[model samples]
Target: MMLIEETAVPETALPVAQFKAHLRLGTGFSDDDVQDAVLTSFLRAAIASIEARTGKVLIERIFSWELVAWRTGYGQALPVAPVKAIEDVVLRHMSGSEEIADPAHFRLEKDTHRPRLMPVGTVLPPVPSGGAVVVRFRAGMGAVWGDLPADLGQAVLLLAAHYYEYRADTALGGGCMPFGVTSLIERYRTVRMLGGGVM
Candidate 1:
């Protein structure tokens, strides 16, 4: 199975100014604009890292998942959280033929952390014998910063500030997430993924 983000969060929705405010560098700090690039980079990194850890997308975007067959007969789990919609489902055959599965044949069931596509009546669209099925969907809590949960939003600011403050210190090494950031997203972390095991 493979998941691809079809569209990324829009640049205008970046929380640069809000993140700066969270850092409390001072309301009238001089040369604020001079550090825009650095600040934005930190913010972006924080957002990406947080999203990866939590399995929750902070902003709404399109995603495409492709797999040869459904993992189980009952349903297939969508890895990301708060999925807003399942746009389409298509089964591609080895002979280069494709079938758009009827939307009525499946229903979306959502929990707090993940959404799933379940067969509507114990009968799901058939998987192609030698090809893959593609699921296109949109997932996220919201598109803008204001739509994010207060704690999650604050968490991003805190993590970004941490990155900015510790830029010169390479003691932590790669992928070592900070304690505070992990604490904020612990509830959103997914325990089990589609194929089984933990995320």
Candidate 2:
């Protein structure tokens, strides 16, 4: 299985100014925006880290996931949470042909922890032999930073601040995420059970 980011978070949607404020950097100075690029990088890194840890997209964007088969014939759980919509599902055959699955036969089951793609009938659409199915969809809390849950927004800031402060600390240990960030994102982590895992 492979996941591809069909659309990325726009720079305009990032909270660069808010991140700067969180760092409490001095204002009204000639170099006020001097470090904006650096801060923005840290913000992006923090957002990626949080998303990786929680399987939650903070910013709205489209993604394409390709797989040979569904996790189950009943339903296929999405890799991320709060999926807003399923744009398309395409079956790609080894013969170089593609067929778009009918949306009427399938539906999106929204869940905070594990959103799923489910069939209206007994089983999901089948993938052609030696072919793959690609699921394209949009997932995220919202399009802008303001739309994020307060705790998630705070977690981003806190983690970004941690990155900014330790920019040059290469010797940092593997478990570097601060306690506040872990606590803030605790509830967002997906709980895997019964050996059910994303393929």
Q: After superposition, how far is residue 28 of candidate 2 from its true place, in Å?
A: 1.5
Candidate of highest lDDT:
2
Q: In candidate 1, how many Å is residue 92 off? A: 1.5
* lDDT of model number 2: 0.91
Compared with the true structure, what per-residue lDDT tens digits does model 1 show for residues 153-190? 97888899999989999888788777887788888787
Every candidate's lDDT: 0.84, 0.91
Clashing pairs in 2: none
**Angstrom error at residue 73, model 1:** 2.5
User: Per-residue alpha-carbon lDDT of model 2 for 45-143, expressed as tens digits?
Assistant: 999999999999999999999999887878998988889999999999999799999999899999888888999999889998999999999999999
Clashing pairs in 1: none
